[model samples]
Target: MSYLYLTILFPLIGFIILAAGRDRLSENVAAIIGVGAVGLSALTTLYAGLDFYQQGGMAYNQNLWTWFNVGGFAPQIGLHLDGLSLLMTGMVTGVGFLIHIFASWYMRGDEYGYARFFSYFNLFVASMLVLVLGDNLALLFLGWEGVGLCSYLLIGYYYVNPANGWAAIKAFTVTRVGDVFLLIALFLLYQQFGTLDTVYIVENAHVVLTDSNLAFWTALMLFLGAAGKSAQIPLQTWLADAMAGPTPVSALIHAATMVTAGVYLTSRTYTVFEMAPQVLQFISITGAVTLLVAGFAALVQTDIKRVLAYSTMSQLGYMFMAVGAEAYQAGLFHMLTHAFFKALLFLSSGAVIIACHHEQNIFKMGGLWKKIPFVFACFVVGGGALAALPFITVGYFSKDAILGAVYAHGQIANLPLYNCLYWTGVAGAFLTSIYTFRLIWLVFFGQEKTHAHPIKGVTYWGPLSILLVLSTGVGALLKAPVEKLLTSAQIPVFAIPESLEHAVHGAEHTAVGIALGGLVIGVILFAFAYNAVKTIANTGFGAGISHIWRTAFGFDALYNIVFVKPFLLLARLLGRDPVDGLWLLVPALVKGGHKFTSYRQTGLLREYASSIGLGVVVLLIVLIITQVGV
Candidate 1:
């Protein structure tokens, strides 16, 4: 328990080591430090987890120091560990460690900034740890911004590419839109509750807050922040473009760490959301629409990583759907399973990209199954989990749990909209199967369109194989404790009457049928009707629909027209305005003065000595005049 801080310290230390050593450290040493740090953190998490269970699984708080005390408004530098944080910490370190291992191999030939890459990678993991482990909202916000900065650095790791830089900036700017909302929520909470301590806030919110208005606005603000980080709806365009970075960066950010922060935030502040049921319903609706939107977008993406990116958004939508229904355990469980399979899919795609000389368009890739049979197999398992293939995969269990919970909550609470959201989840699952298998078929089973180099190494296959194992039903063993821990901690759940309780199990079966039906249709469309599908896509209406979906239903265009264009126009109009000119003149004069003074800084010792002599002569003459006057 005392070693709780080490989970964050280990990676922070690794970041410093890699950053300071930079190119001086061999790739091998950097790999050891980068991967080993997360591995150690994972091991420490395991140790701490065992002790937590042994010691009765109560929440543990360690206050390192007081962060500040401004007129009695104080937040502490503290860490809190309970069932939720423990689960999040384990996933971050465990899945993150595997991603780091693959990154070492993926980045092998990157001679210029190999160490630099690991430094950013390690820092990202450390920041995520701080985010999940923080004791208060203030500390949580610190970690929140920490991951944001790290994401920017990692996404633009290939700074030589202008598009990559833009993608990174887009990510930073869009997520900041959410961060601003989160900051507002903090201010509103502090204003109402008179403290920024999270435990105190969550425990006493319903008790102290008399007005539902404060709760409603605060929860809504929190959801907006979560929506941005999770890439729901309008903020989602940046995620597809984020594929401009290396595939491992895509996996680490999209699959395991940064994107999931929003889900964690909403779940962490469940009490506040419970008080604002309207905002909760908004969360559920937002999730439903986002899943559908992102699923359609995923169907049209040709880049392998972009396909996975949209898929990540779609799956995150499911987690939000569950959380919005107050099914916290179910959402987190899906997140846990998603971390395993999504990382597997992304890493496998990275391997494929490496094998194919970095060709990413799936249409140009085919018959790679024989060349990289292992990667092909990896995709099958990971894709099965992603599609939530019934009964056999971890995703099926977790996703079915979400569908069940959403349905049960709706039925028990008599909310028609929640039931509608449940159907949306089912529809999202069908799309998941279609696009997932479409990716598998297009990339692996067709005629070989491109040559692929041999992929052979422990680094490449090791993490994939480990994640491959977790993508199976073996990982579903976590279901019991995950549900039990959250429920036992007094997390509120909708009570089901005896007569209506079967709806939960019924929803699970219906979801399975939909998944299987979608899988069969997916195989048929890609295998037997490929040309017909292509012809349809070439038709006017079909092409139009495909284009819209391909551009994520033109949300980007809408934003550009609605937000970007007007803002730019305003800037242009103000660029030479009379009032602006008055302010601009100040800087213009400062520049002119700088140019004049810079002329006197001649780089010569003789000129400098002559200037010193002249200054002394002037000073003596002034002093003599003053003495004569006296």
Candidate 2:
């Protein structure tokens, strides 16, 4: 088989092995199979990347079979390996392997579902690979729903907990809302183009529908699908609650693989988006608003995981902004860097939570820097990358690339919106830095406020060490290749003017300054506020803001009022009158039917026999009469 096939197949093999041997395999063996599958896939992806680089944009399609062939249309089961797929494949497998390894240790003593966890983890990786590598829209949809199913299973792995189950349902239901749009978009595409093949659809979409109006509507509808998958705007709330799952699940799905689906969709359909600049602008605005709203939500969160969850939402918003502005490379580069550090942060926090016996409330615990030095160091490195700390980190390079692209847009004399995007991006960066470090100081550096728990084992430290190295170095290493991949050979239509050169660079510097300043101020403010709150609690005056922040800005309450309450009220009204009245009528209908049927039957057996005999005689006489008449 080709490397492309191997890249997608190994994870399936791993999933099968773990699942079939769930009761027999040792945890160590299962971990190896789980992590090894993704690791091998990652290596295959690297080989594919190198091969693609040498060949200079070759598309590899491996057809397994015809999925469907009917009525002048054919959709096949196949995998497509190209620059875009190669990029996503590498990120998914590489990060997925790390998460699997981390989970091996994280789930060690859980005992109840040890084998099951690896099975789900491997399957999740396989589904994600299928998503990235699928050659046609139908295959892609299969991967789409596959990942959604895996997400629900993994999110509610602790199924005994009602809250985790509910969280899983919420995630599945919310994403389904988006998936509906995606399915509709796909059907519409097939209807218009008569083909589900990526290349064919992209190449012939314009010809299939010559009207610009139709093209715009089609593109806009597809983007709605992307928005839901990418967690942009109104659909974004579920990502925060998704932290109810294990930390590694949070890192893998939220940080690396699943949430980036929308980005991939948009990138793959660049031709479609290019046709609809209005849709593109709408995407940018939605991204900007999500960034701001999620950032505020992050600022108020207390649980360590919830903080990271909101951070993921905010960062995803920045990525969407990059896509909206047509800075595909910048968006993807940030995606790459964000994957490394965010995974590291989440994994490191997992170690902390494990060490603290599952205490996620940062206010209850502090001074962990000394207890878990390696984890603390990893957190700092990850946090520094997240805060875009100067020259040394991956986040700096990628984030600066995005800001630079947005600034370049501002140089277009006629486009005032680019300037707005630039400013919005800058503000996003500053807020990101502030909330990120606030998490850092509150969790790792303050006075120890909770009881101490000792942590054990070499497994915990191993995965974290690997991630730390990547988070620090991958940015500079991938910079040139990423820049080339994103930008076309031809010069861009937009240009940054010399007059605005100072302003652009100055804005970047200002953003950096704000980032650092936010970090410093956040640390000081958290320390002071935490200390004062503790003192006030000792004096009984600390309940107000604490209660508000813990309630998550009342978004849940609003949802309850607007969605839950109204639906429940409607159900109640229907149950009381309309449904009950129908049930009452059902009994009368049953009685009337029974009474009508009684007239056809006789009480005595002889009478029933006579009725049957007379009916037979009448039928025969009628048959004879009809034959004579004919």
Candidate 3:
């Protein structure tokens, strides 16, 4: 429990130091505080993890104090350490430490925004920790909004760049749609169940949440919130544009930490989703569609970070698909595996960017494999892992398990829907292989497309190397251990069909053979013939195809026409004070009355008395006439 508090405290301390001393502290000291805080927290995370395992990964709720209370309701401010939170906290702190270390080198000599970067970076990690660790949805939402605000600040870290500011605003606006849905779900759950505690709500779901429509929409809203945070489907456009920030920002938010929050949200509240099968079914569909759409989008991206950004979205789709199919273990496993390799891709790309004089277009890079051999080796491991190459990479096992789950789940449904999801996932896998290798070949394969640029020692390359190792077979070794922990924590495993059991486990020779074949076919189709692919990529037809995908299937444009333009128009209409005319008549009448009364006053006491006497005489004459008529 003490270590749990320290996990949050260390990062907060780093944020304070960096923010308060942004100008006073030298870069070295600031870097130490920034990286050291999370580094120490990582060590503490391992300590907490060891204890959690020894305790059989049982759930522990640690409340620091009562945040507030009204009548009988008290939303405790606390940490909930269970199998899911334990793994998430460990991953966030560990991978975040590596990113911080990398940023220390990556952000060197920015006399202006150096400490400011670390400040936002530190707070970002701390906010995510609070998110996964909260005891109740209220605290969780606090953390959720915290990360969103920080994302806005960090994404627009270069406030001077109007484009960057717009990117940040886009992220905030889009995600807020989902956040509203989440808030509604939270209120509904509380009113129905009288509690915001996740454990309590899950336990009482069947008894208190019997209203079908309520449960369905609540679950749907939760999914929407997760989609916003995780950057799935309709809410996903902001993430790719977020690459306007620093590379480490891209790695930390898009690659590892922030984008995965949706998957975590769904998995954490599995029971709530279980109460609403319709919503859960839609979750699978969203996942399948997102994976396929983003996979194609990744293929056409020229910027290396944008490629990884879309890849992150696609990977998140796999997790959503798994959870949607009730494959909790599989979804969580893919999430963990994605954290390693995806971060590797972004971090490795950072080195290549710095080495190539900040050039991002892979078409502009060539023969860099020799100049930056370290980054080159790292990219192969990361790209291969992302493509889910057979036995050697971690993604093969995780992804195979998810696809098997989709197939099995579909078979149980006795419908084509799950079958569609299964094949869509497989197609995405193929597209993933093509785009990832396409990136590798175009960046590191032939003649140097651009001139060489120098890399700062191994300072940044070092973090890429660590993530690279994790992206390879080294991370695969953890799958079994994590899977065991997940099972013990009562996270249900998907029931694989007897015919496909070997595929999920990665144990059968035939399954291994198929994966290897896919890997070779992917390399052949996308990477082997570099010159031919390049020629087509530069041709008119190819340019048209790229244009379609480069606009992200016209989703951005569609949203602008659909949501953005209308909202802006409404804002403009409201800004003009359209109701002011309705209130103008009252003031106009009052002013006229005041002018008539002033005319009657005549500026002297005798004049005022004479007017009063004339009014009395007129009143008397009218009275006499009325009497005679009577």
lDDT by residue for model 2 over 302-386, one digit each (tens)?
7899888877887888887877787777788788888988999999889888888899998787888888788889988998888
Q: Tens-digit lDDT track for model 1 on 141-175?
A: 99999999998998888899898899899999999
For model 2, the local distance difference test gives 0.79
Query: In candidate 1, which residue ranges exceed 4 Å CA deviation?
Result: 493-495, 576-580, 583-630
Quick one: ranking by lDDT, best first?
Answer: 1, 3, 2
Candidate 1: residue 189 lDDT (0-100): 91
Candidate 3, residue 217: Cα displacement in angstroms equals 1.0
Steric clash pairs (candidate 1):
none
Q: What residue runs in model 3 are displaced by over 4 Å at the alpha carbon?
A: 456-458, 497-542, 592-630
CA lDDT, every prediction? 0.90, 0.79, 0.86
Worst 10-residue lDDT window for candidate 3 reads: 503-512
TM-score per model over all chains:
0.91, 0.87, 0.91
The count of residue-pair clashes in candidate 1 stands at 0
For model 2, what is the error of residue 466's alpha carbon versus the real structure, in angstroms, after optimal superposition? 2.5
What TM-score does candidate 2 get on C-alpha atoms? Answer: 0.87
Looking at model 2, report the run of 10 residues with the lowest lDDT sum.
Answer: 486-495
